[model samples]
Target: MPIEILMPALSPTMEEGTLAKWLVKEGDTVQSGDLLAEIETDKATMEFEAVDEGVIGKITVAEGTEGVKVNDVIAILLADGETADDIGGADAKPAPASSNAAPAEPSEATEPAAGYGRSGSAAQEDKPAAPAAGSKNGERIFASPLARRIAADKGLDLANITGSGPRGRIVKADVENVTAQPATAKAEAAAPAAKADAPKGSAMATGPSTDVILKTYEGRPFEEVKLDGMRKTVAARLTEAKQTVPHFYLRRDIQLDALMKFRSQLNTQLEARGVKLSVNDFIIKACALALQQVPEANAVWANDRTLRFEKSDVAVAVAIEGGLFTPVLKDAEMKSLSALSSEMKDLASRARDRKLAPHEYQGGSFAISNLGMFGIDNFDAIINPPHSAILAVGAGVKKPIVGKDGELSVGMVMSVTLSVDHRVIDGALGANLLAAIKDNLENPMTMLA
Candidate 1:
């Protein structure tokens, strides 16, 4: 029996990916649990593992094949004792048993994603997956489904590869041995050209075609940069957000003197533990508290109705090269300033390395985009869909102001603009949310309460 190995879906939203590398070659013996290949998704380059044992019969797709659609056969595997001559009828073009499943729609039975769905989780499982390929003659291949899939993907000749499993069964561990890394130089060089030929999600949103744009500026001193997967996603999503989401803005300024003092004291006290608190950490806590104080403003637009959460799952924007990541700090209201700060540092570091899983950056009712580090004074951020609001924080500037005693004094004032989805939060609710956040920062002690 010959098994056709198809490209696996690495994420819930992944439609295609680059077959970054192949760890095994044709005629290589494989077992279940072997490392097979490295798949490069939009988020990260992930290691692909084998599930069934078999011999790689043929390699249909070469390494560095980009935009390879999910379920497309990349290779073929031959069953043990069955020579390649017996694989005559193995058709890679046969449609999946269930053809009704749409590429964009996610199925309910969520499987553990391999690379980018969740860090340290199993690979995403699909239903009706090839289970130890069998021939039309009823001869069974004693290989694990996953192993068979891997062999098929690498086009290993099953008859030639020795299986090291129970009763000589093949497993994943026998196939995958190479470390996962970026694609080869050829793939890297071809990326720009690939992006130019790729289809846009929306013709209008994507604007002019690359060819047309290049033609308009022909003979000019200009460089045509390629759009990576992350950039494309960000562009499409943000455009959709601005066009579909009815956004409203709420602006406010908070005196950061007390918060600054509180952060300094906490950092000094926690210095022995190597934990330093940043003003942004305090801001995260304040927003989390505000969500609890003003529960109505914590709601998110779910198309049909507003969905409110008891705990705050705060998404903080961490800018990275090409794009950015909004890693969520789940249950932020319960974490201490030091804990939040520590966890945020970890997420941000991984985000910059493109190591964060989909779940790490996926869900949140509210978001914070702080550009203070860049010396930005004030800015409005576009609302990420499904979330009701996003807070754009600016740098704190020292300015002279009238004190309570009517005397002149200098205070640190930080500006924040909350972009709210009008469909979810009314003006009064938004105002209350901002006020609560302001109060928490102004009195820093109240957050502890």
Candidate 2:
């Protein structure tokens, strides 16, 4: 029998991605573990591998095609004993499977559209069977199994609900929206034509449209830069964070002379090992320790409840070309300053190249965004969820300060701003967490303890 090759979901949250390049063309002989294609998601570009050994019978989607939906048939594979004429069977169409199918892998023919790793036999045994095929007036409906269940329970017609998911496939969200409305209203709400008219992010509704903004620059000789997937995602997420998350900012200036001296001494001692420390490294250490010392504030907003973390997983924002990567250092509190520095250097390098995996750049209860190296004197940062707070670090500058004996002295002062999600952290708890961070950074030696 001929096999169908569906577009694989590279990450958990991915809906659609660009079929960046085809490593194998039609009629190419492919083996298990062979490189199949490269897929570019919003976060990174990942190479896809074939799980099946077969002759590539047909290539449906061409290279550089954007918004290729998951489970959409990308290619056709001819199994052994199967000729090219046999490839046109009904089996070539992708059968809708369970939403939680195992990650697809490269393999020999059978159960063709399953996730990345399982063989044909394992896929059939492990995967939940697709919904029984039936539809109104003999017209088949392309809706997820979960969506069908939800529509049944809500007494909503699948024909009325519209799908915003890949390839106009109805999903749970589309069905849920129809639960409270009449069939006519649901049809209106799900109309793709209506959605196409509205601009995203309330940008058009709240302010002037991009067309109006561009009108002002007309004949001014400006380059019209197109927004890449990363830039578009960043803009939407930041806008959502600011609008949805109730942010409260707390500013503090810490004396850095002691830390500066301590870092200088440590750097000299570690110079032979080729491990140079930066102020940002110290800041990361301080935040990690602070999360432990003030465990009450080490939490994240999980939409329904607060999630308190046991490990101080710290996400440090690394700026890339078009966007930024917040690569997490898992269990950061247990790691030494040297370890953090080394790991951070590697992460930043990979992040710049967009080689980081989804897990590497995701998850953390707290984040540290330091713009000090960029000469930014101190700016408030957006709370990157599900993180409860982010610490924004500024550059150190020499300033006069009052001494212990009531005398004036010159000291290096660095400013920091703590942006907290008011939903999870109150003002008092946030202040205490910031205070602990300040103490650790000021004393410098205590962080080692």
lDDT (Cα, 0-100) at 255 in candidate 2: 98
lDDT of 2 by residue, 316-339 (tens): 999999899899999999999999
RMSD of 2: 9.0
- What stretches of model 2 exceed 4 Å from their correct place? 89-206
lDDT (tens digit, per residue) of candidate 1 on 172-250 = 6554442333346335534543553444443334768768987898999976687777777788778878888999999
Tell me, by lDDT, which candidate is best.
2
Candidate 2 residue-wise lDDT at 142: 61
What TM-score would every model get versus the actual structure? 0.73, 0.79
The TM-score leader among the candidates is 2
lDDT agreement of model 2 with the native: 0.79
Q: Name the weakest run of 10 consecutive residues (lDDT summed) in model 2.
A: 105-114
* Candidate 2 residue 409 C-alpha distance from true site, Å: 1.7
